[model samples]
Target: MHPSFTQRVTALEGLRARTRQATAEFYQKPGVMPPPLAPLIIVRSSGNNTFSLINRATGEVIAERFGHNNATSHARELEADIKRFNVKQFGRHLRDWALRISAILFLFAFFGSHA
Candidate 1:
């Protein structure tokens, strides 16, 4: 049998607490610094077929929308947010890939022309 919504939420909260404790301990070692914690989002469906976007770190309801369609849309929005955050975090390295590819193509073209 499927667990009820409250049970699932409780489990998730427990897991989050444990993870936070572990992270704190790991960073307490000498010469180690802790970075900002990432936002952990959870999507859950209720018995009534409604969906919620929850922030596991703060146990906040990011959003609560009804129906499967709205849930899917919200999921997509969350995905976009993650992508945006990744771009902001590692965008410079990603942009370097374009330059590297261009350099490789230029070398290929130049070498092929001489052949």
Candidate 2:
């Protein structure tokens, strides 16, 4: 399994686990580099796996496949993929921002209307 694919799949699974099991979070290996984003998941493949990061929102793969020989190249690729994932899913962040703005707007509107 290609380590990249393993990591990608494991990360997705971790996300799913986090959703399903409230107490569950991703486990980081003993000495692995910490993942950059919150709720990050890390995986190390043992050389026979192929992996891709599938954007669960769009059912599209965000990263290319990692075959056996390509394991060594996964770090940079995974980092780049993570960046792309964040940008592509910026809507989630935007939605949160919008919700906060709406709440403030609602409060101001209520006060303005009364005053």
Candidate 3:
């Protein structure tokens, strides 16, 4: 029999903790380096009629809805929420890029004048 979603997620969370510990140990070893950890996104859909958006890092339930009848409306709301989140994330990235570019330009203007 297939494991339930909650059970699978619980197992994965245990593995994630172990991986994090191993990563910490690897960093402590002499001259050992690994690539940065990538973000994790887990998506699941079931006919059981429940919806949830969770933040894996913080273990927070950002949003959730229950009931089969409201599924369509819930899905639409979730889609809009995702769109808003994406736009906010995009804005943050743009702001960060602008800051980096400004810093580089400032450095060039400051150092170039001295050279």
Candidate 4:
């Protein structure tokens, strides 16, 4: 996965660490310049083989890579797309108030519970 979240196999701290690492690495990737993104959200499309990194608080899609693999090279194609990409990142709306902190913590908690 793009984030390598390890949701079912690791602890909350692990997920946090991986998420941070992934975010850092993502920013470090050659030519992947992000713009004022906060509380980034990584999404794996349920109905398709698309993986995306977004700014949930702003409904902005910073990057996207298609395929069952999140590490695919398809991510390189989003330079121009990233500049114009914008959309809702409010999740499923099942939790209308999934504030950034809560949402990130919930990702860890939800995975911890499953593990």
| Tens-digit lDDT track of model 2 for 1-115 | 9999999999999998778665333234455554455322233443458655444445554554477445435545665666685754888889999999999999999999999
* CA lDDT of each prediction against the hidden true structure: 0.81, 0.62, 0.69, 0.62
Clashes of each: 0, 5, 0, 0
lDDT of 4: 0.62
- Please give the lDDT score at residue 54 for candidate 1: 82
* Model 3 misplacement above 4 A: 1-85
Cα RMSD of predicted structure 3:
11.9
Which candidate leads the pack in lDDT?
Answer: 1
TM-score of each: 0.35, 0.35, 0.32, 0.23
Q: Report the C-alpha lDDT of model 1 over 33-106, residue by residue, as the tens digit.
A: 77855546677786497888787777777888888788768866885777675756688887899899999999
> Candidate 4: where is the Cα deviation over 4 Å?
1-10, 37-115
Candidate 4 per-residue lDDT over residues 1-115, each given as its tens digit: 5455666446787888999999998999999987764323545463567676555667676667676466234433343355453555435353566676698898999999999
Q: Which lDDT value does model 2 have at 57?
A: 45
Best first by TM-score, ranked: 1, 2, 3, 4
Clashing pairs in 4: none
Query: Residue-wise lDDT of candidate 3 within 2-64, one digit each (tens)?
Result: 569889999999999999999889889989887855433223344467766555566665556
**Which candidate, 1 or 4, would have the higher TM-score against the true structure?**
1
